[model samples]
Target: MAMDTPFDEFLKEWSDNIDKVRTGAGLLSKIRDADVDVGTTPKTLIERRDKVELFRYDPIAERSVDTPVLIVYGLIGRYTMADLQPDRSLVRSLLAKGIDLWLIDWGQPGRGERWLTIDDYVDDYIDEAVERICAETGHEKITLLGICEGGVFTTCYAALHPRRVKNLVLTITPIDFHADVDDPALHRGFLNVWIRSLEASDIDLMVDALGVIPGEFMSSVFSLMTPMRSIAKYNVDLIDTVDDRDKLMNFLRMEKWLADRPDHPGSAGRQWLHDLYQENKLIKGEFALSGRKVDLGAVKMPILNVFALDDHIVPPNCSKALGQKAGSKDYTEIPLPGGHVGLFVSSRSQGGLTKNIADWLTARDG
Candidate 1:
């Protein structure tokens, strides 16, 4: 056995520094010319209403499931995350499995849409989209696949119109908002605690004054949940990924997605922060839309609840709570290893996540 001399150690350090500099320079050059545009999978615009547009992905493989799946993403972020890139796309993965896919794009909402509320989104937009999908496919019902906040929208929809949804799939969705209190870990449910700390009047005042909640403001709040990581992402993490082309591309694509946050409408934002986050209305069966109470017990359709094991934004307990509350007899909860966004984009989760969804829907396609 031998040990390195001081001179040898110094030479090794010098070589490492040179490699770092070379990698950093190459990263900067790639940033200057990198094509980081996302959501490139081919799809057709099927319908449009106000700022909401519904798209149906062009089939890449033979259809196996008779019922189509409608993906609904929340207003805070675009649906681009689902189809970020060809290699790391949830949309493409499901499509490759012969599943018919459709998605609802809640377009960039400005002051004009500030009047919209949860009722308009669930009752009007989602309902209409479901109807359109059913009519187009000549099927009586279609699957509702919701992501994050969009999962709540779909859950509300399925509860309100059970017969319209053949199956419900929720990923990184929070059913019991206050379930984070059970864990009480600092990394988990910071959003819930922050929102609960504010008064209802505070939410009203902000929405009334701003008309729409700025996307950047929400993004900053999310950053506060994992402050250290947010800081390191641009510095240490970026440097670490620079040496690998695929990893660097993934990093840039994520940065591009993070930068494209959309402003949330005032009324809906108010209900979300106050009614759901603060009051815990949805889990309590008190959340209502269009003068109708949203009862989780009314969610009679088969449900596949997918939660991330290490999700900090929406805690595992919060999502797992759905298994006990939902009205479905065949409810299944699958916990994957990753954060909220990683459930959709991480290579580790890509296989299990897609297979679980495709397989679940296929079995229930009766």
Candidate 2:
């Protein structure tokens, strides 16, 4: 072989870049053609109601704890993110750690379901699911792990029926809507700021216009919060992962989840915006669901309040208040490095988040 000249080396670099471009284009084509599979975790549907289902994942490991952990995802999004894939799945990680896992899938809602309120979710749907899980597992008390908006519902459930929940894990759950009023973070949560500007009449008109809050509308609002994210994700980010088929597929899986948001009931949505977001009633113990008030002090179970250090949607201030309000003497606050969604599926957080949850539950499961 002859010694390579500078010009030849430059040509080789250009050729490699061309190959990378080809790979990126091929991955993009696969996405456009719908040739990818998303949310492929194997599970068995144990219970079903009108628009909700309780799913129990098949054990990933031989060993498991007796106290089952019930996972309640927010009504705004699907629970598929918990089990995005085998390698990066929170459900799989928990199951492998010998922790029994159960999840709730609040199926898509219709206009008729607009009357469903926070009370119905906490009292009827969530309470019934907890009962079924307890009945099936032969356990008197189960652990509750709530994500985002579901964290608020779980907090209410645990407060209302403290005897049923043995341990509570809240990840990126917003307790104080005004937590970030003075935060310097550019994305200090547009939801918090926007809600402050709306009046009762404004909320009523918006709710009346759409009997049930449209998932698409909510998606658009989040999109607007990070206008450049979509562009960078499809272009720069996709190009970086395109060469790695697994990474490319994982990116697509996340996108698929984001695209599959669920509609929120109009009445519940109105209450969430006006009471919790606008008035910050949950923390003040003034928020009522069905006919009962939610007292955070009643959350006396062994508590693990986790928040993303750089979370934009739910700021650190929003989630950080859980530890102070909850009555549990065993409360622990974990401010991990990641954004709101990153805490779930990002590699940087997937391990720490799941491990912290498993370890905390193990200590308190008895």
Candidate 3:
């Protein structure tokens, strides 16, 4: 009844091609492992045997900029997204640009770490990391570049201890959770639906079963936001790019990073949902990490608020309004023409945004 001849031929060819690609990927992984061990650096292999489990990627090595910088990644994903590739990595770019960069890796959380709270992370852990970097570098203050929820955390830190911050770079960061309901991404119901479901079901049991939050579950959230492209269309396009060596390698790397989700500590995740989302306390200046109140208006250092114009996670009005709230005399705004993730990943952004940040660092260093 159907066109069996052409369909059957196509199916057979597709299966053969899949097998070939599988073999090729296996070889590529081997060559990649053999040629370069990117993780085997002096700055990496962090000693996290203490009370907290963390990793570091010091791109500057021994040398450092006059203005030191520490990058804080978001909560949901691993820090590798910033260093997704050997070629266009943000760490590599900043290092080449002569900015001393120290990246903190909040390692995958185990079941034991489920009770870790926001107060524990920011006041105790991140503060200790900051002190260590400062003590080692001999700089009283360090530039902090925080992305996504990391930006939110950095904001709190800056407000709490203004004297220890040199420059603050907040990117695609959501501050004003009390956004208009029309904005589907910012609407409470949007996140609440999935978040509530996770809580209602034995998601804790699922998490315990998986040990860490499964990448597939995290990936499903991103897919659900754009059901058409992520679920079906992306794989269709991957078929065409399979022939391009460089593109395929980049694809694989991005996919690998995207598949790797950070295990959000139960306490921290619960706090995020309650204080940040439902209560909307962060922007209201009602949030307190410890005894100190988190008031963004207390941030006195020079601020560079970077936001993607098209970012769905952090809307334009929300991210752009930081310049008004921040107490910095030298405040700037840069709205990149990309999505939340694309602000760092887009080829066009790498060309301009990286240089702009480098130039800013250079100008202020002296």
Candidate 4:
């Protein structure tokens, strides 16, 4: 209970420095040796179209759900997130729960894809994928499981062609983009406000000049949303996990996923930032694709809206707005604890999220 002497304090400082050096060396060794390859769950490529590829996962369990679920990930990031690792994979988790799973990979859009608009994605790419899944499964209707921006695509597709979708599942998606104003919390919805602050011409200029929005550019913008955490992750946060291989591997895997963001097509990028983010078109029932308006009321299929309680990119309110606007009499909203990506990767939410989705789809499979 007495205060430490100068010698004792010096010894403590020296010991701490030694521990830091050892931890740093261990981290470096792991970084050099660790297999950080993501989206590793075994899957087969079933179809391909230009930059998009559709994959069907080999079943790991007896199929309980008659309808197949097609996961649609936005161009901003790769679908590898859903299967970041065997232990924390949403894809594997759902598969283990006896769900037939498929995913659409919007493979790394390049300069050549600059002219591709959202219409091309929703009406062409997603529609073609859905049709292919249907034909393969021999099911008249397949479930659409869309994540983030992909959720908007599925929503549009569902609203436009309700009969094609048996069920609609959206995770960490934004419906009412401007709904962020309701909370105005510093750590949440910064992306929405930032996009809204820009002029339409600003969006146009950026898209026109770049041809395609660079993945690094969007990653930087996302980092800006939580500037402090983004910086600390490499130093303070990483050091805490250096001594634990499992924990350190998880961190490295997540970093691997983040580093693999794909460029978004220019026209689609423009519509996303300008029409949706700036104009707040989707919820207003004004967002259109292929010359047809996307009316939320047209989303009459059973809807499962899973939102993160602490989502910084897409605020909870923005996602929750779907429950009220969707035409489905059977609308469900799940508010899970985590930020945007954590909803899929965090161990705390993975079990419940997958179970909820599996159960929801199972209930409606008949």
Query: Which numbered prediction scores highest in lDDT against the true structure?
Result: 1
Cα distance off (Å), candidate 1, residue 81? 1.4
Better of 2 and 3 by TM-score: 2
- The TM-score-based order of candidates, best leading, equals 4, 1, 2, 3
* Clash count per candidate: 0, 0, 0, 0
Per-residue accuracy of model 3 over 1-366 as CA lDDT, tens digit each: 343798888888888679757765665565453343222333554446344544445554344357778888866887776776666667777777767777777777766777777787777777877887788778899899898888888888889877788888887787876553445544323443455344523654654455445546667877776667675645666665665566666666666677677667776766676677666687788988877779888998888888777766567766766776777899888877877677777787766667777777777785
**What is the number of residue pairs that collide in model 1?**
0
Least lDDT summed over 10 consecutive residues: which range in candidate 1? 25-34
List per-prediction Cα lDDT, in the order shown: 0.91, 0.86, 0.70, 0.90
Deviation from native of the Cα of residue 199 in model 1, angstroms? 2.5
Instruction: Sort all candidates by lDDT, best to worst.
Output: 1, 4, 2, 3
Native-referenced Cα lDDT, model 2? 0.86
Score every model by TM-score.
0.95, 0.92, 0.81, 0.95
Model 2 Cα lDDT, one tens digit per residue, 181-280: 8788877778788778878898788779877888998889888888899679877787678878788888888888888897888998988998999999
Candidate 2 off by > 4 Å: 1-18, 27-35
Assess candidate 4 and give its TM-score to the true structure.
Answer: 0.95
Which residue pairs collide, candidate 2? none
Error of 4 at 253 (Å): 0.8
